[model samples]
Target: MTALHPPGARERHALVVRGGWDGHQPVETTDAFIPFLEDHGFDVRVEESTAVYADERVMGGIDLIVQVNTMSTIEDEEFAGLQRAVLNGTGMGGWHGGIADSYRNNADYLHMIGGQFAHHASKPPEERTGGQSDNYIPYTVHITELGTTHPITAGVDDFELVTEQYWVLSDEYNDVLATTTQEARPFDAWNRPVTAPAIWIRQWGKGRIFVSAPGHRLEVVQNPSVRTIIERGLLWAAR
Candidate 1:
């Protein structure tokens, strides 16, 4: 008979957590990923405090962070710890406008990710951010050839989805994975040739980043294609 080795003492991960915006169900969204990491050899510890940004003690010893909160302020020390954690090889990943559009009051975080949520261009000049838009708009995402050759998306092909077609003002540093274009509707103007990045990956110091623009609802989080992208992204980002 062959003997199996027991798990090691060092097989653990540190997670710094904080987020709000009930629209995204920040708590559930963050928790959804815990099982996946734990199953993949990571001992996950979650800081459930929404004030994790102020708790100096909670920052060190964590291996990665999954942020799901939207629209909050962050202090310098908290930002520093996260910065150090990633620079030391920890990984970070998040989706939708939550993580990417988080901390409306902090400029540093926006600079770290390389973009901010500009005005949602999904609407017309009348209400701008307030009007209702259609769902199941039926969008097609084009997978960049470079993305198909990359680890997180390698072997993945073009797929279609029904969700918010996020039109983002992107940072130049990101390695874009997929993009979708929209035709101008009477309610909005997509007449230009600009493409919206559906998924992207980036780096911050030694840390890694994966961002997805499609998780506008719980159903999207459960979609097979979205799940595949997220699972692969988490592993690829983790050290």
Candidate 2:
């Protein structure tokens, strides 16, 4: 069967950005997001830039950006440039800890991303010191009321998956697209209940942003439904 985002459709464009620590799986992870655009006709460009910060020209000529950078901090100029690029309507998308957990030490980038990774809403804190892992587990996703009628989640259901299910503390400003009802975790000291944003789309300046809190591994992203979420996310996030 043909890929989801075939390149024969039209002239949609995207930039696949990959760079960061190896443990977070940047190179392989971003590749997972590229073919969807390629299969749908977006002329995709891949930049395996370890120095996306130093090169400076990586974001040039791109209409959309799909970032797979994880647990890495960028210089002010580099981060700001990419933020400006996306804010100017070039589009941006990512999942899990990459965009949300990126630059934990930097507030500007955190503000740009709109949320921080407080903790894995599902996992018990006693299970590990830091909630960082590439484990592939299955879980269900609950669509929210905000943008459920939108094109992105139009066909997606409250489906289950054997993959990472991200629970993010999102900004109230986001146009929430979907969510998951995380069961109450008594193990969590901050404890009450855990229900978090599974996916969200935000508008910045002249551009758009979409984020999904899943895809811890390549296999997780390879799922047809997961692929669909990323594909529609790209189309929706793109200017």
Candidate 3:
């Protein structure tokens, strides 16, 4: 991994807030990258709750925020502090349900992130075995023309994955980097094929935000291309 800041530059601070659903393996997944952050010259601080977001002292000095809480609720004051921090130039980044599927009831949070996880289409009943694997389908992440030049995705090619292909709800404000298509098979209800953003970046106020829809687990996060994008994204999003 390359160091982000030049020698002699002020040290950067990174706050990793991870908790909520364990199915996504928040702790393990976030742990996989903490060293990378530290290696890139960040002073890393780890927190297990969103409560830290409400602390102005902590949020005020944070250069980046890596959130991994999924399907969890956020307090009004906590979210307000997070909003203020990001708007004031603290960057944020995360993957899969950690960021996109978090705070399901907070529309403003979704607005700031620029996307939400709608659903992951599952296999037909006849083909299904049991559990979450029913939703795991092989799909290709296609890099866009713009992605060919974007700092986070340049040089990365389309790649295939046999995992949960996320069907996301996103806005035009996002700078889409890569996408995955959910096919309309005979067993599926959707009429036409839909392509959702697989990876993207957004600028909210003075802060930069990066999100990748592919990291459903540690193994997925460790995938070569996915890992490369995320590593680059973390640095790119930092203030």
Task: Output the number of the lDDT-best candidate.
Answer: 3
Query: Could you tell me how far off, in angstroms, the CA of residue 69 lies in candidate 3 after the best superposition?
Result: 0.7
The number of residue pairs in model 2 that clash at the backbone is: 12
* lDDT (tens digit, per residue) of candidate 2 on 185-233: 5554655656788788888787788888876667666667677887788
Give Cα-based local distance difference scores for all models.
0.70, 0.71, 0.94
Q: What TM-score does candidate 3 get on C-alpha atoms?
A: 0.97
List candidate 1 stretches off by more than 4 Å.
1-10, 14-18, 53-57, 119-136
Ranked by TM-score from best down, the candidates are 3, 1, 2
Q: Looking at model 2, report the run of 10 residues with the lowest lDDT sum.
A: 128-137
Query: Per-residue lDDT for 1-239 in model 3, tens only?
Result: 67766788888999999998999999999999999998889999999999999999999999999999999999999999999999999999999999999998888999999999998989888889888789888999999999999999999999999889999999899999999999999878889999999999999999999999999999999999999999999999999
Candidate 3: clashing pairs of residues: none
Instruction: Sort the predicted structures by lDDT, highest score first.
Output: 3, 2, 1
Against the hidden true structure, what lDDT does model 2 obtain? Answer: 0.71
